[model samples]
Target: MSNSRSTKLHVAMFPWFAFGHITPYLHLSNNLAERGHRVSFLLPKGAQAKITPGAETASDVPFPLHGHLCIAFDQTQDQVQTILSSLKPDFIFFDFSLWMPALAHQIGSKAIYYSVITPVAQALKVPTKQKLEDMTLEDFMQLPPGYPSPSVRIKSKAFEIAQLKVVAEDLGTGMSIYVRITSSMIWSDAMAFRTYHEVEGPYCDYLRKHYAKPVLLTGPVLPETLATKLDEKWTNWLCNFKQGTVVYCAFGSQNKLQKDQFQELLLGFKLCRQPFLVALSTPDGCATIEEAFPEGFQESVKGRGWVYGGWVPQTLILEHPSIGCSVTHCGYGSMWESLFSDCQIVCVPYLGDQILGARLMVEELKVAVEVEREDNGWISKESLSKAIISVMDKDSEIAGLVKYNHAKLKEELTSEGMQERYLDTFIQNLQGLLD
Candidate 1:
């Protein structure tokens, strides 16, 4: 009884302004709350209402969460000092976009960085011979491609690869340099990341030991796939398709398909002769839906296929036995769901980590068939059709292989060893406070 009041773990959860980043933290917060820990998830205004649980409609006086706002992109000495003075989280956790980290440090608060995308630190560092895996660094090992969770294409046109390269140099990649930089500047404490053990094990291992802070790895979370019921007309139509017969085509929240590209995919689905569901949701200019969908394709397929514009309950769709294949942006959430479902993948991944995600799906997982495109990145209808058929054809060897790999990977990830590893890390993080 005393333990309940004595040890109330409090973690302040802050994610970058994106669903992918926010959702995980929400789950984490919920997990913590279920364990009786205090959780405070902050929203910096303009965040979606769907994800935000009971977000206050208006706030006059500054709330604890939105103490002050400073852009991470504008990381200036004076600006940082100003920002730091405002944020006073006890333990600050956020995606990389927020720059108020230096401020948290000034307030003697610990900071932890979660790489919503794969940590590109060493991965992005152009390898000397082949890649970071080939590096002589004992810590270095082969990294399977890093896939991003599906969401809006979060971008900063002002921020380029060149700018990131500069940021890395300024922050220092190694221990001594990073330590010195942290001491001299605003950010305090170290960072952990989320990636699977089998795939990014070597890199994760190195980071766990090298960083001053303990690393937490929670990868490939398999989302619950059945959100809505099957009685709906669309759900009923999906049911008419044979089990493991319908190919699900969805390009996450952030991905956009030009009408031309959308038509190509539509033709691909038609060519496969596989009943399919396509997710088509874009927010304003970020990923607009108007031009991304083939005109009249909806009308043509009215009762034949489904078109989920936004918030289609992906996990539920993936869980359905009628769904056999997926053509996705390779976002982590969708990736794991498909993988765990052990369905065949027909990849048409696009943008940022998705390129790497596609590589992971097609190259590493070896379960998905990638739509071949020109060097300039044009996915012709013919290539799209082939990809669809390759994944959906009942007798296709590739389809069988994909199903098998998915099962195997799912087993490994869900095994006792992985569970032990996570419990150990969580305990250690809790234990660190004793030190």
Candidate 2:
């Protein structure tokens, strides 16, 4: 490892083909760039347009077609290699591209498997020698050996376990998702996650011992500043409501719900009887959010609820004083955003990693409440309403406790020099890798 303090390394960013993945890579790139490190970011043209323009990500693609996207992403390997050859960067930071290590080696660059997902999720689903095709629900139900937290175990829920199995299956790619992620870690020069040790230290340490490799932390990778403002229409609407009175619900660009569930979620907001805004993709079989609305839903919630099918300024909205509570799908990026905001959090997770993230929030951190799901993984309007009301109600004890805890933790995380210190140490470690 190099001890030189003045070395500034050129790093390449090639994340998986999802905005959830790409956006974090960009945040890290911005951080590196601010430190005078050269960064070359590579992504598909469609992805590039979405970040710059307002187009949604490939995550909005239907679930059945995700495999095709993976196949296309893999086909870019040769193109990526050619680009790397020309750049000759000192380090390549990537995730989901299991083939990146060899390509980095070809160019004499160190490959860093920089995971945007939580280490708790990775620790629970640690890679094993067993074939993914043969792994059963029982296999996923059992916590991996030496898992850091007993609280983060997979529930006996069939839907959750089934989702895990699906993740382990080949999604049009030749390799299973599990193999793609684990193999990347196994072959990379080092492993890094977009998390701080204060929150996820045990899990990070466990992964280090399990993989026998350097594990680095990037301290949440939040942007230091924002360049944009909330849309005028939203600002106008939210101003009519008092501070901490409106509930905001968004399940991210991905995760289009079933038509039935879509209406149920709307009904949940109506039951809460709070002024609210919901941003979501059109549900399956529905062309617009209005088409999927439950009968009388519009007339009932009339002026109190607004549902939009396009993207809204989420980070800005969360920062709005009127947004008292947020109902999220617990995606990693959203999790960080919610943690940094003052809003009370209610989680309705739809994926494996999201489920684990929700557990980390609700169970481990005690900073949020999770909407209960049925045995088949269906979330009910009543459950959603209950979760939101529990947090939004001023008189509720649980609400006060979670709010206090969340505020304390948020202060610690965003304290002056916290993110800067993490980035500085991370850069020092990168220089060491070149030795």
Candidate 3:
């Protein structure tokens, strides 16, 4: 608690290449730096370019891990080893991609695996490379004993390469997600997570029981300030709407939709009849907006619909009083941001972990509603519309309950010392690694 007694560590950080992974790593780095620890954040040159606006990006890591996806991760091994040799930090906190504990072994430095996903995710991640290689869709359906039910049962059709990538089978090559994660359990000096015990205590216990390691939490690692101001045009646009009368829909930077799915979302928004702002990104290999936007769609909803093709300050939009509901992909970052703003969620999860997260928010946390999917898990426009109307209806008891739950969670998240206590525990664990 006292500055003089704090153990200052020279910490090195390397997160996987994605905004969701990068932002939380930065938050931890900033927290460390603020507490008098020395942190050197290592990022591929490409990721360095995409660091969020206003985040401090002046770091010593300049090498680019070139190529796409798993190829890029494959290429970072030697570069990261070189970084470890050069920086000689007390401990290295790296993504679970490269068997980093082995690299740290060669360099005589300790490695800590830092997970940016949820505790349930970590609990369900395969335990070995062999198991990952052998796993089938049915294997996924057969949940481990004590695994949280309903939330953990992923639809079979959702089992695909995109989902595999999250679990660790990259491009049909490279290490499996189990290997990336469990390698940390076996080799890393410790593990750190972006969660609190209160929220996922049971899963956290499950992980420790199974993995046999010190699992440290970082307590959500929420942004200390949501300072990005809304653009004047957006602010002026939203001003005309009545309080809690807007739907704010964003499906993260990565989860792009097919043209048909995109069209269905538009129709759903229209059916709800709330003034809305929707932001979408074209996924790799997806058609551009010019090819995808429906004919007369924009013109028909001209007065009420605002569609942004690229990035927007999502936190600012969610915080606005006009935003009553959010339809999101349930990525950890977006999930927390929406929860932080106390916005009711209409979940349309588009990825693996997202499927689990959406289920938790809806079935367990009771702060969100799920869009109905076909038996094979395809999202329908009717399902989307039904979910939106359910959440947006002012007199609905479900709407009132969701809002109450969101407010309660927000208070717990922002409570003084909740995050700081977790940080202290993590730092103390890092010190233990040194001892």
- Best-matching candidate per lDDT: 2
Q: Which structure is stronger by lDDT: 1 or 2?
A: 2
lDDT digits (tens) for residues 280-315 of candidate 1: 654334355544556676676665676566567667
Report lDDT (CA) for all predictions.
0.56, 0.84, 0.74
Candidate 3 local lDDT, residue 283: 32
Off by over 4 Å in 2: 1-5, 52-57, 126-147, 150-156, 225-227
Model 1: CA > 4 A from native = 1-7, 52-90, 119-122, 126-188, 206-213, 221-234, 282-302, 416-424
- Report lDDT (Cα) of residue 14, candidate 3: 82
Clashing pairs in 3: 167-177, 168-176, 168-177
Query: Ten consecutive residues with minimal summed lDDT in candidate 3?
Result: 58-67
Model 3: per-residue Cα lDDT over 1-435, one tens digit each: 653237688988887766677789999898889889999998766456656422222121121221245564656788878878998888888764656888887777888888888776666644344544455433443346775644444444434434654565543445555665666676777777788786777777877777787888887777765566778988999998988888999987666666777877788788778888999875334556645666888888898998888778888888888888899989888888887886789988766678777877887788998887765556766778889888888789998888888789779877888778888877887788777
Residue 413 CA displacement from its true place in model 2, Å: 0.7
TM-scores of all candidate predictions against the true structure: 0.72, 0.93, 0.88
- What ranking of all candidate models by TM-score puts the best one first? 2, 3, 1
